[model samples]
Target chain A: MSGVRVILDQDKCVGSGQCVMTAPEVFDQRDEDGIAVLLTTAPDTGQTDVVREAAALCPALAITVRE
Target chain B: MTSDTVPAFPMARAAGCPFDPPPELHRLQDEAPLSRVRLWDGSTPWLVTRYAEQRSLLADPRLSADVTRPGYPFPAPGRPTGAQKLGFILMDDPEHARLRRMVTAPFAIKRVEALRPAVQKIVDDLIDDLLAGPKPVDLVEAFALPVPSLVICALLGVPYADHDLFQGHSRNLISRSVPADQRGASFRALHDYLDRLLAQKTADPGDDLLSQLVTRVQAGELERSDAAGIGVLLLVAGHETTANMIALGTLALLEHPDQLALLRDGDDPKLVAGAVEELLRYLNITHTGRRRVALDDIEIAGVTIRAGDGLILANDIGNRDPGTFTDPGTLDLTRDARRHVAFGFGVHQCLGQPLARLELQVVYSTLYRRIPTLRRAAALADIPFKHDGAVYGVYELPVTW
Candidate 1:
């Protein structure tokens, strides 16, 4: 089985909340500036679809996922 | 013209006045075929007001979105000064095309279509919160802002906990008159914050948009900086603009009860799409688009625009053009509003458009269906309209069901 890890291009983050909304299990946001901080260092396999979905939904194109 | 002062561009004057821009331009379309006018920033630009002309100019290769042109009027300071700019919407062909390409895949139909159900769920949840609120509520605060902002949050992999801070900065940055220096700092703040967040994403990857960019960068498809810049651009453009539209569009519906009634009566996506189009045309939240500078001499609308001139495509004005839209002042959602320039045409059209459309489609349809009796709490005239914003939105749109 592959391990899991969450990646974010914070530089490209425009503070849109797509990731946090879809996968709160994997994403935690900084409300002070609307920036998303990945919650789990390496999320479980079950969180992959939500993580990918959040990444795809981001308007800033700021998130990435890996195993 | 007065001794030291030149006449302001008709489009701008119209923006300042509560009148239709096309009619205002029509008064001068012939007399002053082309006029050089000053922007609020003291920079002179060629204001393209006519409908056909504005459309032609946007697609024209001679004009560029690059703010690097010598004497190019950077609307507010702290802008990516001279080639250091990360905001891709301000660039020309190859660069604009390349950077745009990076973020395009996420918004494609195939990609965005999958997000529909999730977006619907968010809308329903938000509506539940709205229903639980005090009798009188400002829809802008209660529903309009959070719905899309949260959706955008979910898509970008940003933690929802941080929305308020970003929302605050976004609100101020979009204002017509925040100081240049302050705007610059805020932008840097956005960048620094994003950088920190991106670093985290890079170390421990997540399957979000940021992670996708990281893969491209690590895979040698894109540079680390390009990925970062795109993230910031998407972050701001994704939610802020839509938030404005949702708020203003709702106000537009409330102002015209008949249109509101029409929307409330149905939940069809196609019908809702039409309503969104009409709302974009009618409200044109971004009253005037970010200015585009002319790269060379170009002729538009039978008027010759000199080289090195700046063009501010006033979309709000184009939407109300009598020549194009019949009964421009009316809010007939059924009007053939697809041709409107609210989204701007050609290469620089909004990159997040599909997502925006999805959000609007979901929000507008769900809103009226859930709050069927939703009505403006105050008279139309009593509601404060945002006239001073770069993207003209209302201060509050109080409603009661």
Candidate 2:
């Protein structure tokens, strides 16, 4: 269960909101400028697949999903 | 380079691979002529990558997209079969033609053209919402992505409140990394939800797309499942595809500053339409091609494919084939990019295509003319590209004016 991890390079994140769009529960963001920011430092088990998608979905390659 | 060329690029590979398709597809077209590709599922089926061959094959009846009936090529082991084989679009022959025709009336070029004024208003509203906030706005969340979702909801007659549920599932099922095995569940869940919503529409019809379909279906003409099939298809295809186009299309326009300026200065619908085609061709999303199964022994694009073998028509590569377009790799809005298969080809060509095109042309023209200074908020390399999914699209494209 602890094997799941997704690291987002915020510097690389252009806030496409794709990761959040793909897995909203796993990836949430601030409405500061309408872009997403992760709300949870550690995503739950149900979010494992979603996080993987969020990472894969990122256009900037900002997200790195590690399992 | 014979029957065996380099391995065909799988969707997962394309998502992450920093490679372009023209060279890879060209090599296959020249060398393999007819070749096999490894799909998300373990099965490796023959692919037709050349321009003439792909078109020739797409138009051929021997190939089938429906995996429902027997004598079809089912998925191999754990690899994904499409989520419960939707009807009509993936179906062959008269069925595809028949079903596509049902809703085509509402989506005709002229019908969609009439919707342009309304679509422009939607774009303006979303853009206003984005600007109402602050800088570094994620175009995907604020404007580029949600506008299409909202429009489709209104078009389909789905209540605005239900978007969160359906959109969440739709996003998950389309993501490349969600695994082929999981899509079936996500698809079924959505279908079940729509089935109930559709049944309600049958009882209490509205003027939206669902109610219209329900009225036709209850007349005992179109099957209820077929009606539901159309609903499900539109539910997902109606928005996500357009959302991706807007996000990626905007990125493409920004990348080509000259093209962006072209839109800023022109009000010509012809020019806008041509630019939309170029964007569709250049940013073609159906990268894996429409899935089709051969009914019997056949030879296509110069290769021998037997009965029960699968067929794939690499739309993205075909749209980019140098033979089809002069300097296919470069983005030239002025180029006559018509006849591209970004909406797909043959009987199964995208039914929502005209509607999608209308949304694209209007938004592209309006977005730039209103905010001429719109530019990427981050570096191209700084932003990541999608690595997996049923659709090929960018994640988020942030922009600032």
Candidate 3:
């Protein structure tokens, strides 16, 4: 089993909301600005794939998911 | 390809096929993913055709969106004469980020989600009026245009009474065939109108995005001119893109009876939203490629784009690239089209997408379910498409139930 930690660099976020779209459970965009706000540092195992996908797919690459 | 051999960019779509993208674009995709295409001003920009390459390049920081940059390719002819350079869409990072951040909150997914009930109510009311009205009505004017126009107006605190004034100018602004002077006049008219609206918001702030921006302006967090500029960008983009999608998407469904049946019979929100995505990918309303100037040397798909070289990210073709989407040409509503770049890709991706998506979902699901017998009043050939417009759509979609 692999353990993962997700980190978001707020400054780099372009607010495309791809991360939230990909993993809404683990991420939500701040209403103040569309930047990603991590809802859970370590999401459940079932949602890992989507979290990884969100990190990979973020156009700004602001999201980092380390396994 | 060099400037001498490169053909002119912005090729027109084939006759009788309004929904399909320019066939020449696909040919280039199959041949070379990245090759130079000459623009109107004799500048040869690398036209990226493949999906993966486009996705990667759009996110690359080296490509500059600043129109003032020396080698930047202006998609349209002449400068936006009277319009001030406003909003972050045309800017590069830091500055782009600073300006865009101010307007992002109101359009965030959660914030937009909160407006679903209102959006649904608006859609239902519009459909009710549409149903009560006479048959063989123009969908663009009657339904498609009003829904987004109303939603955006309500959001921006712009008076709905002046829709005709702004809408008229918006049409003139986006039409590619409109003469430069006329377009400039339209731009000036809208700019002045927005500036006036912002002043009103500043005086009597309402519970709207523009009003909130006024607070920011008062606090010195944002510039008054920039706020007005944001208003201009939003006023036009907020409604124009979605309005076209509604009209064109509806026409597309009517043409494809099977697809129409699928959308009509099903009330599932997920299914309807997915169908909207497929339609967006299939009929990319924004036909012109995204223009950018390379800030530094960059190599992609085996071609080296030198510093100051112009690049065109043709997302319309990219959405249909066979490598990414199986049977790219077909409009399969069942396809998982979440990856579609219809809203665009990278940092400069659409800001109003969440609201647009919610509005589209409500409209697509409600329009068909309410009027099961809805059908096209005129043949596809008889309907005039906005071929010479910045955004692709039918000028007037005549339909009857």
Best TM-score among the predictions, by candidate number: 3
**B1-401 in candidate 3: lDDT tens per residue?**
45687877898788888888889998899998997788877878788888999889888999998888888887668764324574778889888998899888888778888899999999999989988999899999998999999999999999989999999998988887888789788877887888798889878889998998888898998887788878888989998999999999998888898998888897777788789889889988888878789999998878899999988889899999999999998989989887888877778888898888889898888888898899999988899998888788989999998
Give me the runs in candidate 3 sitting further than 4 Å from their true place: B1-4, B81-83
**In order, what DockQ does each candidate have?**
0.02, 0.01, 0.70
What local lDDT score does residue B364 receive in model 3, on the 0 to 100 scale?
86
Predicted complex 2: CAPRI docking category: incorrect
Recovered native contacts, candidate 2: 0.00
Supply candidate 3's per-residue lDDT for A52: 89
Which sections of candidate 1 miss by over 4 Å? A1-67, B1-5, B9-34, B77-79, B82-86
* Number of the top lDDT candidate: 3
lDDT value, residue B59 of candidate 1 = 65
- Shift in Å, residue B184, candidate 3: 1.8
Q: Which of candidates 1 and 3 reaches a greater DockQ?
A: 3
**Which candidate wins on DockQ?**
3
Residues B1-401 of candidate 2 have per-residue lDDT tens digits of 44344374553333323325535676676665467766444456777766667666765667787766443433333333444556566676566655655665566444556788889899998878876879888888777667788778888888768877888778876775665566677778878887887899988988788887887788877877777777878889988899888888888778778889999988998889889989898888766576788788886555678888877777877777777688887888988776677776554667677678879988888999988898899887776666565576678777898
The local lDDT score (0 to 100) that residue B331 gets in candidate 2 is 87
What is the DockQ of the complex in model 3? 0.70
TM-score of chain B of 3: 0.97
Docking outcome class, model 1: incorrect
